[model samples]
Target: MSNTQPLAGHVVVVGGGVSGLAAAHFLLEGGAARVTVLESSGRLGGKLYADEIAGVPVDLGAESILARRPEAVDLARAVGLGDDLEAPATTNAGLWTRGRLRPMPKGGVMGVPGDLGSLAASGVLSAAGLARLPLDHVLPRTKVGEDVAVGAYVAARLGHEVVDRLVDPLLGGVYAGNAYEISLRAAIPQLYEGARGGRSLIETVRESQRKAAAARQDGPVFAGIRGGVGRLPVAVAEACRSAGARIETDAPVRTLRRTPDGWEVAFDHDGTRETLAADAVVLAVPAPAAARLLAAESPGAATELSAVEYASVALVTMAFRRREIAHALPGSGFLVPPVDGRTIKASTFSSQKWHWSGAADSDVYVLRTSIGRHGQEADLAWDDTDLVRLSREDLGEAVGLTAAPVAARVTRWDGGLPQYPVGHLARVTRLREHVAKLPGLEMCGALYEGVGIPACVSSARGAATQVLGTLRRAAEPGAGQ
Candidate 1:
């Protein structure tokens, strides 16, 4: 250990994903003596990517960031990349229901019926379904203390029609997992808060909207970068380096342990065994990876980490000529409700959503089709070619496309997005408490709090704050004693 180092301490951030990178950036900005980022893969930006297709950029992983979340936008602005931000070309996203496309009901928050009148008018639900919704207003609230699955809660309050028609598809698009497995408290806290507030879900959303309007600061609902969403990660990485953070790629952390002084991180760098000493560490990888790394040091945390399940998914990007598609590629994209029983879960009209995606005269269309879900990994077992074919077929059925795509690309993510299973928030809370007992250690990623880009950013930023605070405390005279 280099005792004379400025701030006289080292901080190690494990995992090269967005969360890890963001943490490193913050630590450097906070004036840490040494900040080392260990990434298992040769490249950074774990799942975030921008691939070229027929001379156009397309995001294969996360497509957009919710503008409402200030974390991502703030980080972008801090890195001088705010000018690259762009909102969705169109805000209209439809749901494929009963073999027909129906526009997603407006004013619904993540498929929770915020406005029954809007939901009813959308024709997404039948007369009986609409009538059953208000039953929630009169029905006695269940007094359950345990975390309940979102599927069950929604069905209990709003009937199975809402669950099957809206919740499942919307959640599937986000978590890529079954609604029955997701925790209402963990996944949709606002909805849970609404129920606790003694108001119907519709009333809660209406009130929220009213308050937001009064605030006059509700930002864009969804937005992406001009070049691609991946640019945000790239900018963050650059900022970290500029701020004096040392990032090491191809450095896979094998184990972590608590040391009397601080912490020890063991990793393999190109087949060489190496260990780093740090005053603090942040584990920002996925749940499974975090579980494996923390098993020896914090078995309780490891168990909770392993308990969180993840779903595999693949993105099939296909491009078509301007005149190839029969139906006009109007809105941002469309989602396939599980009721449709289709291979594709959703498709995003990339070209239409972002101006930089294609040429003006070319009318190039980029479609991102998802595969795999809870108990449906086998659906993604098909070869890349077959997946492309199936995606094309599904798109043709949904949007009347007849022409062959000019280019096609496929990216597979095995256990990519974490599923916030029932009691997930409780488990995460317990894990965080356990980790706190181990001095100079932190964890952040899609598993703990949220899975979106903004969520990851928030977690990272929070971790950085903790690290900086600890450093400041330790620097005080006789502080460590």
Candidate 2:
């Protein structure tokens, strides 16, 4: 920090996920006198976690980062993981429809076709669906009011088949949300803005693809750490501690009160309660936790947060002997459309996708399948054995893998992904506007902007910057809130 930058009093950051840790990093970098990160869980990293299975280390949570967006990669490099960044060995993916797996069509954004011919060749859509897809080019411009659902808009333009067979599964995999309900503005702002301006929504998607393809000349579209993306929070926590920030695990904040000077936070530690005074507080936790902590200070924000629904998801990671599985498992894996009524939503060929994971055990092939999404919590209610059984069942049908796995592990994430309903962005805006009214209070996390790691980091950076700026100005000769 420069001499001119005032140390923004003590900051107490709730939650020790990647967002909270990243906030601590930025806050300390911006000259906070002190920063204390409180994590309710026994460990950090939240959804980004790694563990060993069958003698091979694999990401049990989120594994990849969208390198097309710079926030995550930038933070990785900033935390001294620049050289550790590695792109996936194969980006090619598949879509399982028509009772078989087909190559995921190229030249599209979120499965919205850019080139109809290629989309047809992929055989992802039926003949009738293909005939309906071109109708988008001649359809009258649809007025997309303030905001609309992604699936609703896409279905209207390209036909319900495309939205059901293509868009839903693609977006569903990312958000764990129903595409018909996820906000167009929040999930795909480019598509929203393009739809508002362009004569044809399909044409707009094609143009967006063209621009993205041209920009890809710089580098790959996605990246992962040499070990796992889970290392991010660990690295960020280390950086924060090195910069004089205190971090505590299993510290669940209980109360948040506005003080005359700043704020007071109460949390439990070692089965005992403790209080911490801070000049500012960052609520970098999930919606439910944030709502509970903010009930006293900002009930409106609390109420709004309470309404933000989340989806539960579970991953079944399995390892099989390379020799036992003679059938070729092509591509990274495949996405299963909900219309197919499948138990597993998607599968990733971990060994084929990441060199680090593959190199762990050359004789073993590692793969993982995800089960559950928005409105599909019941799917995760099954025991680990059931999940593994059904996942293997799907693998048998999809990839002809009948051999029993050498090992399998099920990791369940309750309330893992936050859903972005139609009015989500407006709700977030209102929350921020209300929070801005409270001095020394800020918000950051996946629930606010996006569910991706990069989006969470970006949100944390913005919150940290705003809090630091406010503190710096307050320290001026004649400053007022």
Candidate 3:
């Protein structure tokens, strides 16, 4: 170890996804001696994967990152992807409800209506739903103790119609879980903070928009790499390797145990069992995988992790001859509310939304639709052909799009998104308490913080910071004595 790089000894990062790779990067910057990333799968990026359709690159996993949050975009720039970052060509999304695709009403926090006229204009809400909406202003404050499901609180203040047609689909897009079961505090803290004061939600969201707009924010709300956001993790991993981090793939970690000075990680490599000692460990896998690794060392934390649930989803990406559907597809895409009994939860017109995907082939158009959510994996069980057929059926109804695709690809993310039911924050807090009991240890991923790309990177950075702090403190004079 170099004297200048004085943080600590070797650190093994379990999980080669973006989180783990980014953790390694941060640890290296924070002066960790070495970071060995172990990934169970052959691929490194976890949910950030890519495949081409019609010879044009497309993200098979998450397509974009929330640019409003700096973590993900900053990470991209740090890893030499600064020039590749591109904002969506169009953000004119819609809500597929009431048998028509209407413009998604703007200036609301997660589909909570702020402007009644615009929402009413969109026709996303029926006449009955519209009538039931204003009741929120006159109704008594719905008490939210500690935490409450977003749908429950929204339905109470507004109405089930607002939740069913609007909030459900939007929350489904973010969480892949039922809105009625998602934790308000963990999911949307703005509303939770207001709920603490018993203020009307309409006023809360309205003021939030007002403040946001007044702030003169100049950038796009979201961003993606020119080719595909999937390239992000690949770039990050390369950066990690350049910084002296060793990344291992298809090497599944079998166990994690405490050591006198640090920790021991056991795993398989080339059909051979291998062990590595580390001064610290960063566990960045999903809840279940993390639970399994920590089961022996931290049973309480493992048990709590085991209780966290996940949702499965599949994306059907397709390409078509542009002339066949030119001028037919408009806006970015639309979100589907499960209440409408739609097979697909949401659709993004890739060619129309991203300039790179659109400019790739002038004659060909590309798009994708997502299927399945929490407790809704039955649709995902269908094979690629069946899944594509059903998704096309929904698309046909959605935008009258019936052009035969030149190529189609289905990407299924099984147990991908972690669910945040009511009390999720509390559960996470308790689990962290358990993890905190074990020094030289920390946890991060979509499970601890928000589930977006920025959130994941943010989580990784947080873990790296904690581990670096501990290592540096231990390196202090006579610290252990």
* TM-score-best of 1 and 2: 2
Output the number of the lDDT-best candidate.
Answer: 3
Q: What are the per-residue Cα lDDT tens digits for candidate 1 across 1-481?
A: 1123356669999988889988888787777888999999888887787667877778878978988878888888888888988877677888877777777897777797777777877788888998898788787766435677889878888899898889999999889988888887888886777666566656766777677667766567778887778877778888878767788899989888888889989999978989998999998898888889888888998898888778899899888887767668658788887776899998888877776675433767677788888777887889999999998888777877778999999999998988888888888889999899887888888887688989998999889889878888899999978
* lDDT ranking, high to low: 3, 2, 1
Backbone clash pairs for candidate 2 read none
- Determine the backbone clash count of candidate 2: 0
Residue-level lDDT of model 3, residues 359-468, one tens digit each, is 99899888999999999889888999998999889999889987788899999899999999998999999999999989888887899898999999999999999999
Over the stretch 354-400, how does candidate 2's per-residue lDDT look in tens digits? 99988988899999999999997788878999999999999888989
The local lDDT score (0 to 100) that residue 223 gets in candidate 3 is 95
Worst 10 residues of 1 by lDDT: 1-10
* Residue 403 accuracy (lDDT) in model 1: 84
| TM-scores for candidates 1 onward, in order | 0.95, 0.97, 0.98
- The TM-score obtained by model 3 is 0.98
The order of the candidates by TM-score, greatest first, is: 3, 2, 1
* Model 3 clashing residue pairs (backbone): none
Candidate 2 wrong stretches, greater than 4 Å: 1-8
CA lDDT of each prediction against the hidden true structure: 0.82, 0.89, 0.90
